[model samples]
Target: MNVGLGLPVDDPAALLTWAKRADAGPFSTLGLLDRLVYDNPEPLVTLAALAGATSRIRLQTEVLIAPVHRTALLAKQTATLDRLSGGRFTLGIGVGGRADDFLATGLDVHTRGRRLDEQMSQLRRVWAGDAYGEGAGPIGPAPSRPGGPEVLFGGFAPAAIRRVARWGDGFLGAALPPRFMDRLFRDVEASWKEAGRPGRPRLVAQTNVVLGPDAVVEDARRNLARYYAFTGNAAHFVDGLLTTPGRIREAVTGFTEIGADEVMLYCWAGDPGQIDRLAAALHG
Candidate 1:
């Protein structure tokens, strides 16, 4: 399995440094998190900057909230980013669970799932050169990849699995436990087969990691608490933080055993040096 690093979206300067190092490091991809109501930078815009900064590392929005954005605009932005990155972008999308984000975006929280379904289909159609209305032709410039970037759906629900089978190219597994991930992976494969997709869907798993001294562990826990505070269980997330090399290794091995194509480690602290620590832990 390949390893990737998630960008620290809260600090713009630190994120840029991390992006550059990730490009030069042993990591396979650079991942981003999205939240409109948060301090984090917008994933697509950040990715465009990273595309200009780095050449080799693949970029992914660990899961962009699809229900909040206009379908065609999102499609155009993604296609443009994919082209700019030379086809090194993957669209990991989901109907986000944050009600505050929905309210802020003037979107109905209850209709998110249905809206996501419609949006995913529309994104594909727009990417496939389908004409809009009367005057607008297909959205351009065309995606670097034929049908746009590889679409990966996040969330582990029956509906999410069905959506992946129908419109996505892969599954993006977020910070779930190992046993849960095992079942989720099985369900994804079953759903893909049931949907008559030709091959197994790609699976990517995400987890949080903090390395270096004890201060770094505290920083990670504090940052995680702030990021997940909206969930009302920030302590739950902080409690699961991986602070040691052994824990990180164990997490990586477990994900790989459960058929993850890639394991993305999201750094909780806003420090660029975290990438080097992670690389040393995994590769050295």
Candidate 2:
């Protein structure tokens, strides 16, 4: 399976430096996460900057919350990024779990799932150059790839899986345990088949890592705690951080064994050197 790196969105200097290093490294993809009312940089805008900075690495949003944005605008931005990146962008989208994010966007949190469903359909139509109304012409700078970037849907719910089968090209699994992934992989396969989709859905798994000395590990733990504090159990994520090469390798192997086509290692701390350390560990 191919390995990818998740860009740290909290620090601007570190994020840009890491993006450059990742583009030059052996990593197959560089990914970002999305959140409103957070310190992290906006995913799409960050990606556009990285697109200008790098040439080879595939760019992705680990999972962009689709329900909060206007469908046409999202489609336009995604298509623009895909074209700007020379067709190296893959869009992973979901109905985000944070109620505050929805509230901040002034969107109804309860209608997220339905909103994402409708948005995905509209996204396809927008990317296809279909006129929105009688007079409007197609959106410009069409996606470099046919039908826009590959859309990967992320969520563990039955409705989410159904949406994946219907509209998504892949499944994006984030920070899920192996047992859960086993079940999820099976469900994705079953759903795809039941939907009469022609081929198996691409499966991608993501998790955070913190590999270095004790100081680095502790820093990562603290950062993770702050990042996931909204979840009410930051320690749960902190405890799961990969602090050793052995642990990172084990996680990668385990995910690959369960049929993940790509595994993205997200760095918890904003240390730019973490990229080289991770690259060495993966290669070593």
Candidate 3:
């Protein structure tokens, strides 16, 4: 299995520094998280900068909340990003569970899941050079990839799992245990066959991490606590943090053993040096 690094979205300076460094070698992809009502930089805009900064590393939104954004605009933005990035873009999408995000964006929280299903189909038709609805004609700056950037669905809900077969190229698993991820991967494959998709869906697993001295590791724990505080179970996420080379290796191996095509380590420490620590840990 290949390994990927998740960029720390909270720090602007560290973003490019880490992206350029990771591009030199080590990680196969650079992932980012998204939240509309947060202090973190927007994933698409930040990744556009990374595209110019690095030539090789793949850039992806680990799970962009697709329902909040308008379909036509998203289609244009994603296609442009994919073209500018030389086809090194992957759109990992989900109908987020956070209500504040939807409420803040004037979306009906209850309708997002169904909306995302419609949006996914609309995105494909737009990317295929079909005249957009209302005779807007084909949106220019077509995606570098044939249909669009590869789409990977995230979430454990049945509808979300079914989306991988209906519209996505794969499943993007969240920070969950290997046993859970193994079952999710199997679920995605079974759903794919049930939907009559030609081949197995790509499976990618993600885990939060930071490998360094006690200070950096603690910084990560604190970050996770603040970010996931809304869950009221932030302690659970903090307790699962991967902080040592041995722990990182175990996490990677655990996911790989479960048939993950890629394991995405989300570094919360916000330190550029974490990339080196990750490379060493992966090699070790």
Clashes of each: 0, 0, 0
Q: List the lowest-lDDT window of 10 residues for candidate 1.
A: 7-16
* Candidate 1 regions with alpha-carbon error over 4 angstroms: none
Q: Whose TM-score is greatest here?
A: 3
Q: Best candidate per lDDT, number?
A: 3
Q: Which rank order by lDDT, best down to worst?
A: 3, 1, 2
Model 3 gets an lDDT of 0.91
Identify the runs in model 2 with alpha carbons over 4 angstroms from their true place: none
**Model 1 CA lDDT for position 185:** 90
Per-residue lDDT value at 195 in model 2: 94
Please, what is the whole-model Cα lDDT of each candidate in the order they appear?
A: 0.88, 0.87, 0.91
Q: Candidate 1 lDDT, tens digit per residue, 74-146?
A: 9899999999999999999998988989999899999999999988777888888887547877878789999
Q: Model 2 lDDT vs. the true structure?
A: 0.87
Model 1 earns a TM-score of 0.97
C-alpha TM-scores of all predictions: 0.97, 0.97, 0.98
Candidate 3 at 12: error in angstroms? 1.5
How many residue pairs clash in model 2? 0
